[model samples]
Target: MTLASRPAVVILSQASHALGRKIANAIDGDLHGASARTSEVDFAFDEAKAHLSYLFSTGRPIVAVMASGALIRILAPLLTDKFFEPAVVAVSDDGASVVPLLGGHRGGNDLARKIAAVLDGHAAVTTAGDLRFGVALDQPPRGYVLANPENAKAVMAELVAGASARLIGQASWLSNTRIPFAADGTVTLTVTDRPRTAAPLELVYHPKTLVLGMGCERHASTEEAIELARTALADSGLARESLSCVASIDVKADETAIHAVAGHFGVPARFFSAARLEEEAPRLKNPSDIVFAEVGCHGVAEGAALAGASPSGDLVFPKIKSKGATAAIACGPAPVDPDTVGRARGKLFVVGIGPGADQWRSPEVSTMVAASTDLVGYSLYLDLLGTLADGKIRHDFDLGKEEARVVHAMELAGEGKSVALVCSGDAGIYAMATLVFELFDKGGISDAASRIEVQVSPGISALQAAAARIGAPLGHDFCTISLSDLLTPWEHIQRRVKAAGEGDFVIAFYNPVSMKRRTQLAYARDKLLEYRPATTPVILATNLGRLGEHVRTVPLGELNVDDVDMLTVVVVGSSESRTVVTGDGKSWVYTPRGYSGKSDTGMSKEVSQ
Candidate 1:
């Protein structure tokens, strides 16, 4: 059970719309309606329980604006362990009462209080331990991980029954928590990051305060790095689970072993420049001239540890070495946030925005765009991003300056800024992704570009969007061929088109025709007509997934070169493809998947040329 980072409000009655809107506005949450009175609502749904179930399945905390009994009956079947379930609250339609029905300690109680304050109503929090004391032992504030949660019920009962408890370590969170601590009590509550087994009457809290600094030889095995890092932590009696991050020099930023160790420890891998590491050379226990000559830094492990340490922090454990790796530990005055201390190894994300539509965009693409500190692309593509490009340094180039745009984005990433190279459709399909790798292969890839991490996020390609809108014309085997002769020779394009037609595969033609190039669409249609019938369904999808989107099914013989342009995607159906007009009088084109031979399903209809 994962909690949604964003909250969602579900309304069941028209009377609750105003209250739902108020809660949504106050909580900065999305609204699912019971009516059409408010245009600002994110969505409107007719079935209240199913909509709530859908939002619940999305891992979002739900605030249902309905009777508490009704919400309880609907959510009863989906209930699981309280430890993992997301917060679910019930708010009255008139905003008079706020009740935390489930996950009261996890997040429901907090959400109920917030909603209650907004509605000027009282929160009915029913958690037993919270009423007796001010805090929930199982949910011990952020930055504190509760270990031995199974023992929470027994200890809380003991405390409520007037039994005393002992508090160990610096638990500042307990200052205002009113946990009924007794200095010499039998129930021990330890708040240190150490590998310790909790007794039946005890609880353990691990605080994220350790920063592990590591350096490894090129292509070192992940097992070697993990063993060496674990040994260092074991010798120093530090819990590996408390590690905040793994810090290293930027040159080792791409080191697989370092990332593997960080992953094993469930922490982020952070990197710093040679100059930043050199600033900590004076604090290094083992400074090396060879290291300085190779990486422009005197030390790696110790230097990186100190660099990530607090202003007054020191290396608790000096550099410890393995056959191919070195590890060190740093103690900070506060929790270590590696992001603030070191310059991250630069990152470049080649993202596809997917035909300028928000819904068509993938979550990974949205994440990459949001993580980017700078955006680089063609001016029109960048403009298509709309508000998603806000607060970023925009570097827009012309349509033809593909190389310049890619190089500039890579350089910015090399300079330690996260850069997004935006593309219109799928980045890997005739887009900037290939150009990036080509630059790397041609030795035009700069050293900084070489060190920078590159990731390609896929988008909804034009062919895919077109196929979906036109009802699975590409249901069978398919191939995509671009007819652009500016790069590839026209002879090669003709050969691919002919081969696809002969192979009985659905073909999606990109760059079918342009203002200057007119003969390619007609020529390709003539070649496909030889293998497929004249009445073969041809789908012309223009501006797919965007405003003014148009889709029409025509026959191969009737395809007009005058009607096709660069913005259009032409999908030519295979020999087995068929078209049908549904009961609503809407045309649907689909290719037989061959299950029709054994099954008695009526799936085929006649096609008109």
Candidate 2:
């Protein structure tokens, strides 16, 4: 194996600084002591959880000199034996190697080989990989496919004891590594010291799996809570298959998300009782308490960690916030070797349909929604997307209840649950996308959270569909102005109209002429006439793309004040738009391509000759 791809080393020693640095660097690895710094001299085990978390999270190979045992003792209480991380080999200051401590297949044996080569010393690597090639899967490492990540520690433990292991679906590059496979096809394995009859059972592993669901009433987020849990589990040698559920704070244990996780992992969604979470809660620097209490736990990370560990392992209290935390499953004890696996990112998509109509939808939109695992939005919107929501989990809320929908979808995704947040019309056009981004920006989340990738799927707006049905009023660049005084003040709307008049932009009116806000649109149209031609074409599109649709074009000066309603979209064309004659003698309104003589530059022209 190339040295470049080799996992780096971490040297931890209380004294014997000279020997520690030399021995660790001989393997061409970084010396952890020189690379780390802490001003607080009284730093204890959990205090360094932040730094240790960074090292263990990398899944690298590790080696520790049998030091004041402070490094090992401080770390031992937190790691799990199951994950494939850095190999850990222990040695004495006298330069004598003793045990292949952590990461057996993927870590420990490598440490043994490096030590043996450095001082002409003996490395206590009794594993099959080291004994055979004196090279190992953790050394001249051959990456193996462990079906279940949970059995990694147990398998590594056996191999280091000189037990035989046969890997199935072993990748080709691993042929030279110590762990062997039968070239014939499926390889058999035996984890015990006594060899058993060569069979598939000797090597099969069932992966460890976890499901996390939490809320914070305190300082911790899903990220912080889960890392603490991961460290504890990694120290004990357990691996999680995947996190796959999140339930609302009020949802019963019998809820679908909860039960589904149980069926997936063959384990129950053990609740990290809300009260217990509150007791351990740290004071958050931001708006996290509301989220935590709403979801019932500080964060699902705690649940994920607890579930990842041995049933006997206790919950580890969390340390202070990481300075922009590192993504890690856990920092475990040094290993003889480890069995690392691949990572897949979770997903979330939010879609808006504009005012309402399929014709306004973009192709990029429907495709995204079709691929999502869960759907979230208002009940009416969900019903509108009936065909798409058929089998997926629907997180439904009331119409104006936008924040809850975004939070719920994000929470579900953070738990490693792929989900989608549904909106009406372009999500960024004032639906759910903005809310989605706000949640992420708050840093009110957890460490274990799989950050949800927020995507906005665009759809047809009432004006665009309306414009298409009546005339080319929107062909020229246009600005949309909403007359609703609920959000934008009446003064702001007036200022915008003044700007639109100066810019020569086609103007589309939303929330136009609502009964309660009768004067705004009238004031706006009068303002537009100040700069625009009195005959500027006004097309009122009502019920665009829906049953009972109607579109009418009138002169701006002739607009009937009483005819406008909230459902109507008022589109007033710019000065360049005009009425024209089609080849068939049918009359049509259009905003001409500036090069009207012949050589066209419009989108349609480019698409054609």
Candidate 3:
């Protein structure tokens, strides 16, 4: 299945002997002639798994020749992946062009025409979409990710009717867009990526469109302005290149940021009228004394685009400054056109940075945080992000109550903004993420919230971080019991701890010893002593991965009651978890390697605590 351009023609020759020479010649521009493989007949295909399927997968359209019904049957299944399936056309060995089967997009349809031209005959072309519209934008060869696959056929059909069409989304990243639909004050959009610059009348898929207008002092430092702008975008988790253009007054053509920003995104810098700017001054981020005296524009692109939107989304300053400092303007969740309703869905991400530090933060969770527009959490959690939290909308509430924060973040996302509800440690380990779904499951989310996208990006849990800090106590089967009893009964906690002890499983205790709940860890330790030796290693990693953190691993008999706290993770090692000293005398912890399938490394060869 060597894919080439769309086929010019499909030759249904009775045998390869008649037309093989000419067919190979046209395919490669160089003549392979009739000497190609010809003994490929009358054998089971199971014995003939020898055609070059690799060549067809190169994304080149191919012209496939099916000489017989057996060939068609074999080729039919092969063509399903759009790789090996090239344009297939059939011709009689008498050199008469006949049936042209599948693939107008593949090289088959084009090949049929080429072969017909060479043979002085007519090629069979049955595709109306190709003949009518020529090429379409939604038909980008390799990189087109259409938001609505179901509506594509209808959209294409509408385009073929020669209706005036335009594309308004990040879809403009495409090279071959040929839609015939127009925006009649209806803008369908996806706020996930930068949108292509478009007129008022195009159908677009750019989900991350925003109009930014700046009025800075003459020769404002590009670094200051850029940093400010970048902070605004980064805080929103939106890409900068998605800015269609930097729209400004004609006076500031020499302003470096206008060109810098446009050049950064590889787009044009559009100029708006000063009079229009005055009309829009009301919508700018700050009611400035300077901009009025100089640029005289309130919101250049932001206000105009908002005014242009179908529902005319409200103008707001999502960013704020201490005084008359750097400035910005934000617009939209501007109602998408009826056609663009589902173009791109908003995303809500819950991130868990394990127990107070960067080392325990999972890379995936960090990425989601960096891509979020707003950060909602207890103040300390948001503060942990530091510089990363500079530009985002921060909703810092009190500790022990994150349910309201989660609801707020989801609401923001429903309005077309990407939000991150921050959690401590793993989002699913007694974190807000599970509560979010549980809330959604109970119909707590609205219609808009339901339409918004939500996904949980997990991070390392506190207990995992604690265990890793001490030893591989959780190497085998283990149970995590919370001793707080705030969410569950103390009797149930005792029952679980007793079961774990009876089962001889290692136990990782969370919320082990708080100021009020002091006896559970002692009770659990007492219960564990009944099942095994009292000298088992007890790893206490307190305030792990944070400032003033300390790790202590001691035998169970030497466990200190004073060191354990609610912040501490208590790992009571199993029979196999051991302490070992490396050749360099560095004390470390690892589970016995017995189950690692390397039988050579015995348990006794290493030092154990």
Candidate 4:
């Protein structure tokens, strides 16, 4: 398994915040600080141990700027399997000493060394194998998998005790290690692409040198495709861990069966254009004119395998077929790099950033934005991403051109790029998600755009934020109405306002007023007063979750248009809503759930008894 890329640098005291920032910047990680002591950080937490435990549970590598003993005590209970754990390193508050306390082979030693380089300190790595041989046998380098890990401990112990080992296959990484190698030795280290069994004093490593090319008919069964590929690998006597990637023609980039086969092998699915595959016609063992007439390529499975395995590679297995799928395999001269060979399937993420705070942003939204190659949204929405948008290619649009931004995002994703369409509040509620589906339903978009994957991630809305800032004015039923009337007709908006007022539903007005539009909020207040009392509470929350947040309440009779703007969300309480003043001279508002009626009935029954 690969190590987690982005680490989190955590600090307990304000004094360690500076050192944490330095380490975080060096590693391109997020900085988290104690909420009671530190102010300026990417994230703040109330308890250090709880936060650290949460980060660890989420598989986030941690670099804590604190005492080693304290971190050990806090995380001692969570020590399970060492191989699956994330790297944890503890650094002194003065940035002098660095120690890898957990996941030494998984990445803790390397992370501690990197942090020590930034601080000009030393990494205290106590692992015997790492300290003596400068490598971990169990944790092989990328593009190589250790077949038998249970025997690694015994082999390493023998090697550390002055036993000579013999190298069997082509392995440049083992040449640099501090291993005593001889022409004849008792201990053996074997590396190959073929399947092999290990002896008692042996460790077998498999290099990812094979590529599997696949093709399937439309709506083919995923099980059939996977079984065909697995049968081909087994018949050829090849290890599944030695497979580099699953490749096919670009037209099948969105094919479910092809992607499923890749997923089954835990490898990436890459695609090449038909023309690129046609160039390998001379090397294909099975080329057909009928296939060329159908797909513009002579052989999809064989051609893709040869092309993906590099020019000098050899096709080992040629054109094995099932009822609806074809599979082939090829061996390369060296380990293949899947990313440099073919294009990946495109993905579009419609993400809502909530209001503006990092704390309010959902974890899935953050992960989508970080994985995105391009970010498309309004200027203010892109600006809200702050440091997270640093390295991304940004496509900014003005406020009035909402359709233009969504189209640009879709077009970018069509070109095989991961695009994030940023939105404020919830993406599905008055956001770009509806427009995306509308484009798909209307049949006006390009074919590539239609084939690209789409995902919607939800976020906290402005109404929810406003309701939380004040007391729960939305305790009962509620509805939201946009008052701009730019795209919506004024008469339709007025009718909805009248209906909500008659139904006595709590109303939250979004897009209350722009600079050019006014008088809508005042008209809504007048209409609501006809059903509810004049003393009903009206909440005006401006800049929710942003820098200058403000929430206040007023009587419905006193509500006016001048008090609201585009940045505000206005909530009008129903007739049953009540406001109370606390001892601190602050007002809170909430709607009752009718528990008083139940109390009265219970008291009557007691009196009868």
Candidate 5:
């Protein structure tokens, strides 16, 4: 089964939509919206229950931006095995609270806390062990696996009830994690990745520390390669689940059978250059001159296995061969750290920092940028990051040089360094995320980018920031349109504007008026006036979520072209959008979601004392 690379954030209303996007950004997850609401996100679902049902089956973490009661009602039917269930969290629409609804130990609690940090809110974690001891016996960090998850509940209960626990293995990482443990106790926890039997009332965890090296002929069958690897593991009495990755020479980087074998075992296929593999020649059990002539390595399988393994690692299985394939296994020393043993796999993070404001930026964006060794973006945008961009290798280009920026970031990531391709507002919304994917699809320089792990982090878009600045003008159905005709033809822009007006969608215009391009915004205004009334509330917000921000409301007929610039986002209200004079004597634009009579279900409103 294929696994989802990231978590999903589900939103149902306009208030929740912004918060959901922030959560998704902080976690580098997919933003999903309910179809009933006006959603500008990654994916949309027709029905909430059906959407949740599908997400649950994917075995990926899920964060729902909705009321707790609604989430519980939708997921009650899908509740089965707690051990295998993915983490599910419920976040309030106003970003006030985060609740871990299920899989608290397995990831929900951590996800909720992480989201809370981004939103400046609090996590309502109810797990007993987590509350008392700040520990979850079942959920360990990367490279660690729980052997008997069934016994975790009993042990956690005892720990929460003030019973002491003893750790029986070397776990330096746990010391900083503040897990409650004693030198002597009734319960014992064994932390080892190797094969072992569990003692009475004792829990065992397996860390991923085994490196499997594989080599196959050019046209070797996938079945033969996979079977041969499995046979070798079985003969050695080693659990396949403990294998961290499959290692091979870079010459076979694109080899189909090798990748197929790695996929079958649910591990990544890591490739090393011939020069790197040759360094492990002395460690090879069956060195060959013919193999050195063919691949410039004495032993492809054995050399690669040893090269990827830790310094203290030893070859456990040596050169087990099939008709057209060869396999070897190297056992890393106990307490094997996966990140340290193998060559660093490249990673590219496409990040949106949210409308040029530090406060609006999610914690995930900050963390990702801090972790990245290289940063690529427009020169001005990089400068906006200020001190956060310090010490990292920054590759800045002109505003229009999007392709060059992406290419540079991809190249750095290909060299096994962490890279961040930064953008303004939401990366997926007419930003660098699309360009990065396009570059990857176009091949050549992007081949390295395609192979490297990529993640897109959402951010508060210009439209969302403008909507929040003014009241909720986008409470109902809405669509965003960019009036810039640089890349897209004006004909297509005209058609989209007409369609959006005909559909009665609340329209947000990006790149409304530029110095050279002036006619498109005027033409769009005329098209919108045909369907909307003269008194329709139009919001003009400039520099949203940044310094020198300005927001004002005007009637559709009175909108001045001079007031809007390239930095401004103009949101034209739909027919259903209404205006109210608040206590401050200012007009607030809002479109009712028609949940007026429904208790406990409405677009979250600001409460005034």
Candidate 6:
């Protein structure tokens, strides 16, 4: 079980938080805490068991700073596939003992060791192979792929039973292990980059010594690039599992075909600048003047392959061209680190955080924010992110500088940084998402900005929060309108308000009233009163999901500008909407979905029957 990018260190009590923080820092993990019991954590969870299960299901390595028995109990039911489950480690509350509960051979044992080292405690690694030989043959270190894990148990058993093995190929780590090596032995361990099958008593390991370099024309089909890459590997007698990464010129970073080829081989897609690739011109076997003229690189495929592999790496297969794509293969002396070579494609995530509450924020939004290298947003919205905003490069903008904030985020992402543009409520509803696309459509941005990837993550909207707080006022049809006439003309706003009134649609008003702009809300109320009844319920939900939350209802005729503010979301019920006052003197608002008509029709049918 390969752990995902970041692990989660969970603490259930404030007493364990200090130890949890130490482990989290050592591993660069996010610290999570039970919301009701702990504070000042990166993420808050309502329940420990549910959160642990969620983290495990998402393939995130977990280091629970709790009792081993309790942690096991929470995750026991989910223990199905050890090969796919993330590492699960348990650390004592006082940080004395670290135990690898599951996925020991995968990552748990390693994580436990690291944490134990940090906490100055003991790592209770109970894996038989690890304890005996200081290595798990089934799970080799990075840059080496176990060809046949199914055959590992038999080989490990033989070695554990005091049988000697012969090393057929180069493996520095294995030499350091406790395995007894002999010139003539029954069991065998072979390590090579070439494609080979293991015998029944032999273990085969593939060193990731190959780099697949690719280049494609703009808008090239993913199938063509993938096929070209596969053919290059097959024709060169190379194993696909031996590839470290798929690489190309930086200009093609966002090109779908380049990413598709990388995805096909289950490797990262790295990129090199044209100048960087051009530096390898002396090493290219197929240097093309045409390519140099096109992208300032004599050989994108060969250059990228050599550059990505290593300075002394050689191209095993020269550039092979398809209709609109080219591929090559290079062999390095050792495994290549994709991150050491070049930058990744830039990405801008336009995310909405909902109404200032951790529980209201979507898991997708949290994930994106955690992955981002930079946070760009209004200052208050960034504050709402709480500890999730820790360690990020924050570019805080004042309110009303929405365009500036969006542009900054785009420019940062254009420079190969993962940037999150934070907004309140839903990003698509009167937020930065519209402006992001608008700038793209207008086409005034830099080349890098235009090519950067953009993703929009939805959040709980103010309208939804307002409706939820005040029963189901939005149970029927509803439309949201912004009352701020700063960007939009008042006539257009008046027209939308009048139209919503005429349509008898339940209306939710955002930006209902600002300091200088108070009359718009009154106009909307008067306009809505013309269509709906004076006694119709009007819900004013302020600070929907945050502290000092206030939700109240009043008659449409009595809706005044003094009662509304910029922080408030005004929801006006339609003619069919009703307000129910309970015995507790609390008012709840909801619009019937014409259930009365259905009931009456059913009654008539029953009477006829």
Model-by-model lDDT, in order? Answer: 0.83, 0.53, 0.57, 0.89, 0.81, 0.89
lDDT of 3 by residue, 546-570 (tens): 7878887877766766779767888
What root-mean-square deviation over C-alphas does model 5 reach? 11.5
Per-residue C-alpha lDDT of model 2 across residues 539-578, encoded as one tens digit per residue: 8877666556778778888887687886688888787778
Error of 2 at 456 (Å): 2.5
C-alpha lDDT (0 to 100) for residue 7 of candidate 5: 80
lDDT for model 6, please.
Answer: 0.89
Lowest-sum lDDT 10-residue window in model 4: 1-10
- Candidate 5 per-residue lDDT, tens place, 1-609, comes to 112536878887766766777787688676777766744555656788888888887787889888889888888888889988889998887888999999898889999999999999999998876776667778977777788887887777776677777887776655554556788887888876557777666778777778899988997999999999999889888877688889887657557898898889877788787888888888889999999999888998998788777668899889989999999998877535545544445778899988967667775786577668789999877876765676679898998887778888887887767888999998899899997778777775744456676888888899999999878998989999988888999899999999999999999998898888888877888888999998999999988876789999999988889889889999999988999999989878998867775555333542221
lDDT measured at residue 543 in model 1 versus the true structure, 0 to 100: 90
Cand. 2 Cα-lDDT: 0.53
Residue 305 of model 2: what lDDT?
37
lDDT string, candidate 1, 490-545, tens digits: 99998998899889999999999988999988999999999989999999999987
Give the lDDT of residue 334 in candidate 1.
64
Off by over 4 Å in 5: 1-211, 215-234, 237-246, 250-270, 278-299, 309-316, 321-326, 331-342, 383-391, 592-609
Q: Which of the predicted structures, 1 or 4, would earn the higher lDDT when compared with the native?
A: 4
TM-score of 4: 0.93
Worst 10 residues of 1 by lDDT: 600-609
TM-score of 5: 0.58
TM-score-wise, the better of 5 and 6 is 6
Q: Of models 2 and 6, which has the larger lDDT?
A: 6
